[model samples]
Target: MNKITKALGLSLLLSSAVSVYAQQPPKHTYKPDGYSIVTIETPEDVRFHATGLDSTSTGEVYVATRFGDVWKLAGDKWSKFAEGLHEPTGLLVDDDGSIVVAQKPEFTRLRDTDNDGQADEYSMLAGDWDFHDNYHEFTFGPVKDKAGNYYGTLNLSHGDPDAFSLGAMGSSGGYRGFAFKVNKDGEFSPYAWGLRSPAGLGSSPEGELFYTDNQGDWVPTSTFHLLQEGKFYGHPVSLAQRPGYSKESITNTAVEVFDKIREKPVALIPHLEVANSPGNPAWDTTKGQFGPFAGQIFIGDQTQSNIFRVLLDKVNGVYQGAVINFMNGFQSGNIRNEFDIKGQLWVGQTARGWGAAGGKPFGLQKVVWDGTTPFELHNIKLTKTGFTLTFTDKVDVNSVSLDSFSAQQWNYHYSGNYGSPKMNLEAVKPSKVSLSADKLTVTIDMPLTADKLVQIDFPGLKDINGRNVGVEKVYYTLNQLRK
Candidate 1:
């Protein structure tokens, strides 16, 4: 093909992709919050629950199933990429086009040797760490970094479900309930320990690693933690892997001392409120292709069958943020999701063992922005007085007042117990409401403190067009008072 021919072909490909996304996707309705959720049609045999997925520049999408198969979605057909592996949990397509995935025991790479479109070679890319035969000892990632290293989170072995034993959070093998990295030469090094159950992992566009952990023993709620090197994430079970940081040492340590030492999450998703079992988090890097939510992170929930948006603000070298429920009523249990080249969000879900609110067993859904900037809470930035809320639409200003919003503050207790209830509940009275000159930002008055979770209810708040804000409730974890 000549340069002119190649140029024409490239232009046509781009045009076609844009046209497909321009149309309203089929089998999905417009969300009340100005988005559409569509379930993509898969091959009849692609019934296995998907754990992770990634797409290519040419829009070729691939998924790793919990049943140990990788399939590629080309146009309307789901072609088998590879088969017969362990219970794989995460998937990614490298620059060389080889598919990398995380299985229960190891990380594997699938490559099509003969250009036949079927992966002929299945190589164990990493797993030099440790794994046990326990049912809950699931391996979760390969979230790559700019340096070409792969990372994964290992879940600790759990005890019998009928009995609430403390051993449920204990590690049976080496570095269980920890996050580790593997280099190109396949050198495994244990990095961060003390994670309870890391369900999903991914890196930001800036290449910073982050993972989502479920709420359970030693974890008061589901959270998204910044993957800082050699940091403990508040679970004593995994400390058993670190010699000096054993369970006995943590048990003997006072709560005050533990709080000062343990690394907290960037954002705390309230249990059963925003996320029951939070899955993978995908950021909006599609520029304007996915709407105005560029740079914000979208997190999925398994049991709740919902998705929420998080806005992170770095202050004083620490990360803190807010979470707002974006959409609910997804089919099946959401496990993983990724944005395609066209900015379409393909969500992979499975409800095989755990029941979900969507009433489905498994599904593949896509969420697209319908070009509507719905009235919503876009972000919550911490301020000296309290925090400011930026909305998607211009506010009426008259709709906000000292009596217009209500806030409740509480903190969680980390114990060997299954979970925690809201402790020290207190109502916070707002001193004032100040609207930004752009009318898109509102400064609500509330006294915030360190290590406290605030739940603010934006009651009767509406945009200038009289449309009510979709997400009225916003949750913020104020870990740092100021920068």
Candidate 2:
């Protein structure tokens, strides 16, 4: 028989061979000092779960919750700004101050028709999902790349019930996940295929998309797969051997599929015990050529309750491989796991499901780098900030603390306060500004001062260990308003 025929004939055999090898738990070294954790207030003090968070250029915070709700963090108070979502996972704001949410199986554009704070109607931007069965568990992303196109992922929660009795292993036919894109007019189309549970989705500085998947609980190892356009990262039949299948038979079939996906992934994190702490995945884009992380990918491991950094070494235009490790830990032993955002090498995490301080189960943390012979920061942008500041890469937020800018002048620096910056810019109106876990933006208000010079500093930004947080600065000359 031909290659395809031969592979199919012994597909069951290869599956069994892969099963004999037990998956070992991946090691994650602790870096408690890499991050500066800051807790933002939650809407419901009694009970709340933060699903999605993003900042605007003006510094307003938008946080999505489980109860079909979106909360805004302004100053110290939380307010219900948007509602009627069925498990919001990803949040993004457009240049027009419009908000978009990926509410599993649906990508929704929430608009406030009357200029009211709350969204009046939920406009279906573009989503083609079978929401009835995979309603809440599936993860759909509405992330807009620098090019303005929207991308999202679909996740399969559980396998089919009949497949279990039929000697089938892993997800079989019930729910197959894929990635898709939406046009400007809200048309949904398939982008890529072959994903088990792609939960977290984000793009790197190089315009590559990365996603996290939850393999079947029965499998020995879970997987974190990366994608380009239409590549399969091995799932369902590839990760685990079928229950009654022959090892040699399935192994051959899997090799062919593995080859296709193996090259696409920047790294393969072996998932042992609880999906290997898989959560949101992002890329660090905060370097102007001086440092170790000119092009690195960052992700969060929920199971270990830590954030991970995957450094990529590309040789001759091809990605040779990557080095993975724990970037930082949160709240002593608390699970500061999942919902990750990145600035450059600096990573921000949202605290969830743990008895820790800082916004308990809902707040933001900043990871920064210290400038020395080895580290540097450049290509920074205020980007979209309001309630949060979304960077092209991860940044040290603690060092960039806000103390309300004074008209006279001030001196501020980073003392491990997330290696932010020295200058602080305060809004003319406290209510005009908002904050979130990672983004900051300006809304409605005109620019401040003819020559508004805002400076931010970071004194204690560190690496994985407790070192100095690096310094990276961006300047925006604010022009006075025209009367």
Candidate 3:
């Protein structure tokens, strides 16, 4: 009753503990190589649900939240810089040191008078466009051009009389669903029309403006477009705001007419697989401070709760590119991203109204590079025969084979429907695969076509050390072929 009974009881307890440990789920963590995410602590009482992010020259970070407040981050402290904004979606620290914000009503400039560290001057920069009390008429951007003009994209409203019956996104107010420019004199001019849910906007390293749009009626999927003046993107309902056209006139126009004039997007962000709600396209102007991805575009997805990289190229005078997954597993919906002076990428997150994968309501974080480069695809270029894929590091040439890569191509239909399915999908078989002498590039010879979305999967790709690449898939929007 002493030794035998105690030993039997202890064995049963240990067995139960082991069983419970095996049944528990494994902890999920995001540890991308060569980069680390540092979560920024916010005020316990404040929601800090950020919608826009920007930084000053002195390395002070500013965030505009959906709750109508602008907060500044200096060192490790957060302070309210301004308040009473009407749901600001984008913020810009102008060259003049004034904070210009794209709020729901208008673009407002906030100036910190007397060096009080708080903005006391609230002045309107541009408010020519009309706005009703609709909740969906959000404005994004205020990205400045080289000519000193400020640009903002207006979102289509819901519950409007002129709203398209297909996608339900409409522009009852003037200039809704359009990109407008505010001149230095504060004169407002409509620049480009036919944008639906233009959530993110950014200027390329060359000062060329680009915008990201969500998938909806008239939008096949999430898209990134070069914001050229007078170019119609895709949504036909936005035509009602054009001169000589009313709601009835636009409704009577054929969809073919709009299709013919619709400008192609630089890249189509694949739905579900890539991003459902993509935010700002922040270019890595860090100049190698953020590792090998200098000059590439880093975009955060609000719904996916992740950041992806875009490598852009110009073909036949048009902008097109590929998107590769960069980092994932944020704490909330990553709505805005800004690169600070130290080349660290600050991500502002929110999950209000729409749900996000991160499961948190609001937060802030930054991604820092450890100076080590990961083995990944650097960029992809369309060649006359096929494609030229470059890598950040040397590749294991022995692991390269025809079976290591597979590809498919498809296009979306232009219509009044909500998010067309991938049409005419077909497998693309490569005829030849060649590794470059430097082992940093791969050339594939295949039958190439124009005006299609090409996806290449290289799950078996490895670096010179025989380690797998960081990202295994690449989605390229092929609008043109090389001459």
Candidate 4:
């Protein structure tokens, strides 16, 4: 067997352990063709810099750098638009073309000011005034809602002073938690609290907000927390706090907070040993319900360097949810790990290597949900039958079916007939997706057959809403099916 076939066999064996729900696996009939990886040039002196990317109504894309500067990518040309700011962590473009940026303790606003596409007026919306400690516990950039309100998390640490320290600061409190909002009128209101390091924000189809929190020592031992608005989320207490606060109880301090809120997040995971640092959460509104997430939320994990898509069910108006680790460890750096975009998740790697190491040059990365692409193959033997396709996307011990390819141009086919004749590309699950909220890789065994070629549809897979997935071509070869 060739190396690709061998790798495919092993990959299928590992995919079986993936978490399965009532939904069927997304089918793939073919892969993309004429596809190639294109690497862009990093701006000179761009080392040690993080990125914040946001696109405008036009095709213009704006990127914020870690070194306190803003750059614009107009087509293939990169231009430095703004300079001399603090460590700009996040960036967002508002409805009226205004820009919102997160620069540590302050959330700043920028406007074109002169009818130009570039921002000319820069103003600080909130800050402690002290240059050294105007900490709002804020890091990630603000996300604007259809109602014109801005929302995001503001995490503050509070464990061991040494572990919680950051950016030249001496001993500091661990990131407490956050769920804050800025209204259309610019009025800022603090909502949910008790998050450690929530690096990402996402809104469901129902307009209810959701966030991903990182768990550490003295906190959630193994899982990641899903932030719900107007809820206090027993931060120091780590979910399971229904039994009257003991150790790690932030509920006791509720009276001290102005809002006096008290609601816990939807506990997403348990002891999986998957460093639970869940980051940016984006909802897919196209397939499910209309406005809210329809119970879907996507998050990024820094420690494991991965991403996830969680479904939040709103039965009878009560929101409940579960997380499916979608993407696994990226071959990018560590540190500032993130994935926040409308279509495919865009990962930002700043650490080093594809594993759990740190201190590497930072760069922006993307994971394209190419429905046409075939997942890694699994379990193969060199015997006759031209190589039996033993594995299947599922293991129901049922019959197999042969269907047409999703990519009409490629003419792909699968030997397995157990599932439906029409393969749903949207339902295609990653073989070795993430287990934790972060980027740890867990191999999942997805069964298949030697004679079957999965059909993957492109149009069926849409964005957060029901938008169509666009690609140039579909590529698949029979050679890829054997081990």
Candidate 5:
């Protein structure tokens, strides 16, 4: 087809999609109680399809949008701080009040030198990697470590094109699916590879780096993986940057070799059940100021238009954990989130390139807990028998029984498919139930299964006061059975 014909065809298809999308109800319709979602109004001039969010010590909020602009929200007033940036996916407010952002081509730091409320000094802290001009070549990052180094992830180009609109088999990009770290002196280097569409990057409270990668051809499932150097995270295309690495080394290698070498996700989220495109993770370190689940990670989904909570546990020096659906019915696709000093969550949302379930195109909302502690299992600790669950309140053993619990074990296939279906499903029967004297812990008599996911549903588990569990389901990744 000719150029004009192709353009017309694409335009028509997009318009038809918009017309169809307008007629359907939002994907997220269920509204949970006790928590309120307050929409914070952004500026009227631009479409505030915010993708990055951070806040300063003085309570000023900063946001980076897909339109290449960064703004600060202070006491209901929006002020433009920076402009004419690329598609920025992440934002961080440094300790000195400077704005650090991760744009498509590089990571940058913007500073308002004159206190004029606008950034006059723009510094490109990291660059010179590769850009293929492909539509899917998006970058996400600039999250800092305790040592002041900046980190980001480069996404693999998905289309069949070259860097300059020319046709090619692949873009010949460098470090496309790799994660990099920029030192304090602006030294940029690739740190980890095998990442495809890694949308969010953050540090755990324990000071370990982690990122969220989406499900695709090489990715078996949406996962949350701890960032370890030299780790090939299942996607082989990124191994090109490794020293002496080859395509044959990856493609022809056995699954056992890859499994033994590459790292695993701390928590594997089921497709479309909890998250479709999980975004950034923000931990609630408020020590009960936020809620009962302190030091837990709360993540948002762009397509799912919801939020979920993750609890991590280390077994044999490796991280594995549980993921639970926390809250839903957000105003848009949640891409970036920040927890303020007051313990309220600031969610920046967008539906620009992807459709969201909240029925809106763009919005900024504040998620606040209504001060009511929800009865929930906080974490699962490994034990010799099986595992022990710690809850927010004392468990009433009278309300917990075999009838209230049902569990099974399942594993995923390591392959090149779009995703992995649950394989080797096994029913797990609880041989006994042991409650702690304090009522906060419950030990089950089920035997521990190594390297398997235990799918537990506690529909009848209740707190000491007979309050039903707020989160009924939890998928625990039990990697190792301890003695």
Candidate 6:
């Protein structure tokens, strides 16, 4: 009687457990159409707060962590490659198989001299700029151009009394708040000045260098800039670090003078709405492997914990374009993105000092295209009179009307303030709206204006398959109009 009663009780308990498990919701219910996120597991004891990511031609993925360790991922295995770095924020795998990293104090090259699986050789490639031991002085690149020159961006100091302070940031050491270049011969030079917290850097498919700066004092908002030589990028406090300018001189110059000479960013990533602390811009050169948005830029935000797509266009010989929401729901703050040869995007995340939207402190994840194209905005081109909106799929013309679209325009005032509020915000109604015959393009005619951020929303638009557009709003930086 005892054996039969015990067996019957165990069977009922196991059955109840299975029933409850089946009733629970699945882990990833918010699956985005055409893209899926795959989390790569890290050791529980390791911080794994990834700041930079890259891959080798042989398919090994390397990650540099903010805790000063580099890890290599081969298949399902993880191994430490290097250590003892001072918060490396960016990593690159060179053509000759050397690994380069931008640590807070120097640009280092890590190599395996004995053909071991770990990096044994740590060489200082460049450390010309002065470091004042401030926690906010982060270095952020090693993107090599076709000419073999490596580039990087340096962040300004945060709490140094002697540093020239303006709005929210300060610069005291040499070349702080500047973009620098190191030649193949190991020579270093400051390329561009006036950056506040340039967190990430990358090279476009055509070899143009670009960077993402966080919004702070002197910087009205987060920005994406085409890093050109000798250009000032709106942060006046950094001008004190320039060769001829002193702290007194920069203080004496009016804000208007700096504003007049500073080169505008390619795109102003809207503060809070889009990105609070934007990271690197990784261009989609994966052809069709990563889906339809080839040649566009994909960037991640630390505070937003999301990935946003940038559709860039050359208008009147200058780069200005739109920023559209792409994907969110990551595990931590996404700070770096690297596309592998198989066309998957690897995101490195961290939430150290200021924290991030994703509840975790650090993680690593990859985004893969499911081969199904999402019905969304493919690109936004500025026209002579208005804008031409192109979609990834055919639109349902019956679902669109004049009431489906609304727009507003505003400009940010250039000041020494923490961050400028939207100045002179005004509603911009489209004078004419026309859907193309093929149903993949929409043309909106409006009174075009320069130096304004124009946001257009088409909330209820649907594709031919009756699926709602994945992203309904786009923010376009109208710096120039197409002739």
Q: Over all chains combined, what TM-score does candidate 4 have?
A: 0.56
Model 3 alpha-carbon drift over 4 Å, by segment = 1-31, 161-166
Error of 6 at 225 (Å): 0.5
What is candidate 1's local distance difference test score? 0.78
lDDT of 3: 0.83
Candidate 6 lDDT over 283-383, as tens digits, reads 88789999998988999987667889888889988899889888888888899999998899999999777566787999999999989988889999988
Reference-based TM-score, model 1: 0.90
Cα lDDT tens digits for candidate 5, 71-98: 9999899999987776778998987888
Model 4 residue runs over 4 Å out of place are: 1-40, 114-118, 128-138, 157-176, 221-229, 236-264, 270-275, 285-296, 314-317, 333-342, 352-360, 373-396, 399-483
Q: TM-scores of the models, in the given order?
A: 0.90, 0.58, 0.92, 0.56, 0.90, 0.93
Q: Can you write out model 2's per-residue Cα lDDT over 1-483, one digit (the tens) per residue?
A: 111111111111111212222343334444422334454445445334555666666556676654467777666777777775666667777667878877754677777889768777676676555543433245556677667779887665433453321122333332335577776767776676656556577766666666665433222233444566645554434233323444344444543444444323443343332224356665544453213445555566544445555434343353322223434344222211222232323122333432222223444444454443333232222222211222233333443333322122122221111111225446332223332344222122223343233222223333333344333222232212223
Tell me the tens digit of each residue's lDDT in model 1 across 1-483: 111110111100100111111212122212556588888876686666888789999999998877677889998888888876666778989879999888776787778999999987777787665655556667888788998988999987665243223533666657787899988788989989878789979899999998899877777777888998889887766666676665567567665675567888888988867777788888888997888888889888777677788889888878888888888778877888799999998898887665666778788898988887888888888888888899888999789787778999898887666667888989988888888999999898677778888999996788899988787899898888985
Return the candidate ranking by TM-score, descending. Answer: 6, 3, 1, 5, 2, 4
Model 3 residue pairs with clashes:
none
Steric overlap count per candidate: 0, 98, 0, 76, 0, 0
Task: Give a tens-digit lDDT track for model 4, residues 195-277.
Answer: 54566665545565656654432233222344555565534432222235433343244433412343333433321222244
Q: Candidate 3, residues 1-483: lDDT per residue as tens digits? A: 111111111100100111110121112444557998889998778988898899977899999988788899999888899887777789999998999988877888888988998887888888877776567788899899888999999988866665454456776757889999998898999999999889999987788999999877788788988999998998877777778777778778888888888998999988776787899899998989999888899999887788988889888877899888888888888989999889999999998776678889999999998988788889999898988999999989987889888999999877767677789999999888989999999998888888899999888889988889888889999988887
Ten residues in sequence with the least summed lDDT for candidate 5: 6-15
Q: Sorted on lDDT, highest at the top, how do the candidates line up?
A: 6, 3, 1, 5, 2, 4
Task: Give the whole-model CA lDDT for all candidates, comma-separated.
Answer: 0.78, 0.45, 0.83, 0.42, 0.77, 0.84
Quote model 6's TM-score. Answer: 0.93
